[model samples]
Target: MEKQLRKQVTALALYQIIGGILGILLTLWVMFRGELVLTQQVLRFSLFAAALFMFSILCGRMLFRNPPRGLVLSLLHQVLQVVYFTFGEYGFQYVAGLRIGFGFDMVGSWTFKFRVALSSFQFDFGNATGQKFIGINLVALFLIFWIERLLEQGKR
Candidate 1:
């Protein structure tokens, strides 16, 4: 792997690890605090969140150990965040939505960082029930692209 590619992988790995830790912490806080009753829906959501965070940490570890697999996992993870997915009290639906060319996201009370920009940070808080979230996460998309390009170059 090239120096540039190595650095990007390291950065992504760190990001994933840190984000996973923070998410776990936040989910715990939300659960313990009793902000919402522990219903099947909420419990399911919490379990899913925890599982996803753990998966992210695993992806980060994989990235550090194996770039090819790591890059693919990271790409899948980012694609998941971009894809249209929703879990609500009424029911859970994970279909129908794709944002290409630009970035935008709409989420409810469950708040998380919607990464935007290649080398920058944008943070938004959630407070409204019916909120329309708009964000840009070109960073994840571009980083995976650049990493793949670098890997291809290295192969040649």
Candidate 2:
């Protein structure tokens, strides 16, 4: 890699690692923050999510090695962030069609990096019910793809 790209990847690695840590910490806080009691099922799910975050942190560290394997793992980390599910809280009648939205939620406040969207564009920083969403972490994806592109350019 070129010097400039090296610096960029280094920065991105740091960001990814920090994001993983933040994701874990935030999930923990949210898990126990409210007065609502956690069911056994929810606790199990939270534990699983924590494990995934920990793995993501490991993937971020691999980016520091800058090996071919590192690139693969880093990309996998980003892909793992992608999620698929329906809110199913309420039906959308105003759009009258399937309204798939791309947006950012609370930045791993309740969940980890998720990249699941369809056709709409939006940014959600608040608590919205039926129409809102927890979409992809475009930042993470953009950084990884940028690094890949820079690496290819360096190869040239």
Candidate 3:
């Protein structure tokens, strides 16, 4: 049980690092492209998001020497992530009538189907930037999985 827990914690840390790196790269990409299509608030928030994820990576790296220490540190990381995601979604939905694109569409698809007269319909942004973000996230998650596999192998 202890060994398994350690592995899980390590995997979580690896995922955090990979995710943070992707976010940072996205921010840099936006910076170089010289686009002001989004509000300044949005850009600042994106930087905050990247920093938040990096903090998780730092926490994991700092605590890895002791299993118990790492477990405690990781729990704090989890709590911060949960709080951030919850508040972030709430704020986005309150301001933009949506929390992450496709959210409304996904909910509508699940709750009601084939409704031609539903009074409201969700349309995807279908923007190139959004597609780029999706691609980056996908790659980051793949890297996280690869890192987990390597860590698992090392454990054995």
Best by lDDT: 1
Ranking by lDDT: 1, 2, 3
Model 1 lDDT vs. the true structure?
A: 0.57
What would the TM-scores of all predictions be?
Answer: 0.64, 0.61, 0.44
The CA-based lDDT of model 3 is what? 0.41
In model 3, pairs of residues that clash are none
Clashing pairs in 1: 116-136
Better of 2 and 3 by lDDT: 2
Comparing candidate 1 with candidate 2, which one achieves the higher lDDT? 1
Runs with alpha carbons beyond 4 Å of true place in candidate 1: 84-136
- Full-model lDDT for every candidate: 0.57, 0.52, 0.41
Residue runs of model 2 more than 4 Å from their true location after superposition? 82-84, 87-137, 150-156
Clashes of each: 1, 1, 0
Summing lDDT over every window of 10 consecutive residues in candidate 3, give the lowest-scoring window.
92-101
Question: After best superposition, candidate 1 residue 78: deviation in angstroms?
Answer: 0.6
